[model samples]
Target: MESSPQVYVKAPPPPETLGRPFELMDHHGQEVTNASYSGKWLLIFFGFAGCREACPTGLVSMGAALDALGGEAGQVQPLFVDVSMEEPDITGLAQFVSNFHPSLVGLIGTRAQTFATVRDFKIRREYAMANYSTKETGPRINHTAYLYLVDPDGVTRAYFDHTLEPERMALTVRLHMKRRRTSP
Candidate 1:
């Protein structure tokens, strides 16, 4: 008796609805919306400046990835969206973002605006009581750490786990950029 060969099937891609329009203020206090980034790819991460580990790790990875991209980095914009409930302090935000890549932009908005953007991005965030805190230090927030890659048209093309290496992340971004150029 002869055995039949098994065939493998590729799975369908996920729906492209993870990205949506948003209006937020940049670290410089300038208002910006999703449309503000038209014609350029966006690498967006959601976290607060106060996050002790994950936020810094993700931002450093993003900065390194940008560096790896070299000239191509100009076509990509890196964004850090604050998830804290408190109103944004532009000075502090500017100072915080200065520590990372010079090109990285930090965004913040009213609580309602932040919530809407977080919901649109399908981010999961929760607040946990800190063992010790002051009026300035609110409860710690735990949130999803995936780095989202959005196309120039404001569509989410892919996402990378926070733990992924910067080199790999740069390669993945390059691959996506190539595909975008080839696709109609």
Candidate 2:
């Protein structure tokens, strides 16, 4: 028996997340809870900063999509979570994350903060490269490259798997917002 290689996926036409709750942080180091997004849909990506590719690419596409959404995209809030716990200090991750997507914020606190947030979302991360960690010193993390879309009500509505086409992702998100607008 051998361990399976970790893989990352782009937004893969995830189901609709019309009503899921999520409590995450904003780029401004503010406390952004699920309640904070009570009236808007959310596009959330849980990834690390040291990521060589997927992290930046995903956020970049996501940002572009939001920008493309124009006024409609205002209803959507995109988020990024740093799964690294090697150190309480996330200066590296923060700096790295912000560089890609200025609006894409990174979260950091204690091991408990990471655990509590990740656990609630049912997200998991395995440190493969052990060179540095927010919780320790050096460690590469193994995390799924899936994005979770939560509804305004703070409920799990859909999941965009890895390898999701950018146009499709942006369209899907836009569609969700359009549907929300029509629904009473």
Candidate 3:
């Protein structure tokens, strides 16, 4: 099911929260951060690897759109930021992300740290299946998909939904790049 635009959460504007930076492991278990992504446009999204529908389809659309971007996509980075507690370490998250978009990088961390980052980005998730943890009530994690465009300066300037039209997403990214280049 699709969510109303208004019901969707919005990430804070660029540089809004320098916040507590977490050391998330990438696909290779290499260290990465918001700072490490500087100097390139970032298409940062929040969702889990196990999400059966929303996450996979959304990413497929994103990758196809970026591929259509041709060489311009070289300036863009498609990032998979995970908040799932199933991942025990960075390597796990890295492997999970690599399974989809080979070029896509995955970032994973402690629940507290991951949740904090998600909160900063205004990402939202919901419990789906029975609780996997004995202490928790439910099992699987079903997330609300959100797409965030973080500029080279580390500012989140554009936002869209999980089911955002591919053509529109492409147009939006192009327009953003154009504006940034022409700006004083």
Candidate 4:
């Protein structure tokens, strides 16, 4: 028997490597497209309502980061994309994100719509086949954790992982905003 060489790879390229377009409804039932964010910066994250660890913490850190920016926050828009399979409507998305930040906009759509966004964003997600509610723990859906910064031109400029601090995040956002302002 012959052996073949195997290669190990991680996730897809960083989200900033691509500028995919997306269209989804906000919590208020308003349709928001890539163009809607034109002329402003967009901070986007994909997570579900039932996420107990990374999602909520990321949202909190984002809100704190924006707060740290003070007036500069107005130059950016924070969007929490609810990619949870459990939430099929805008109401659930709204209620989920409301607990974190007042200004954070929660986005939701049909399963197909959400799946489309997930695919475009290159977000990795997995569904557990076993029902954990019957056990000591609850059901779990795994997803990627990354905070993306999109420029006014609908281009992704940066992405942050779990180790990024709020202060650093805010500073990076300000620098990007400044660069955008200086550019033609």
TM-scores for all candidates: the values are 0.88, 0.74, 0.79, 0.85
Candidate 3 global CA lDDT score: 0.72
Model 1: CA > 4 A from native = 1-15, 131-137
Model 1: per-residue Cα lDDT at residue 61: 96
Report, for all candidates in order, the number of backbone clashes.
0, 34, 6, 0
Clashing pairs in 4: none
* Model 3 alpha-carbon drift over 4 Å, by segment: 1-22, 87-92, 129-138
Superposed by TM-score, candidate 4 places the C-alpha of residue 123 at a distance from the truth, in angstroms, of 0.2
* Model 4 lDDT on a 0 to 1 scale: 0.81
Q: Estimate the TM-score for candidate 2.
A: 0.74
Sorted on TM-score, best first, the list reads 1, 4, 3, 2
Model 3 Cα lDDT, one tens digit per residue, 39-125? 888887777765556677778777876877777888889888776765455655655576665578877776776778877776667
RMSD of 3: 6.7
Which is the better candidate, 1 or 4, if ranked by lDDT?
A: 1
lDDT of 1 by residue, 115-184 (tens): 9999988888988766434423456787999899998988888898788999999999999999999989
Model 1 pairs whose backbones collide: none
lDDT of 3 at 150: 78
Residue-level lDDT tens digits of model 4 in 1-184: 9999898887767656654788888889999887887777888888877677788889988998899999888878899988775546677677888898688998887788888888877888886676653421345667888889998888888888745899999999899888887988
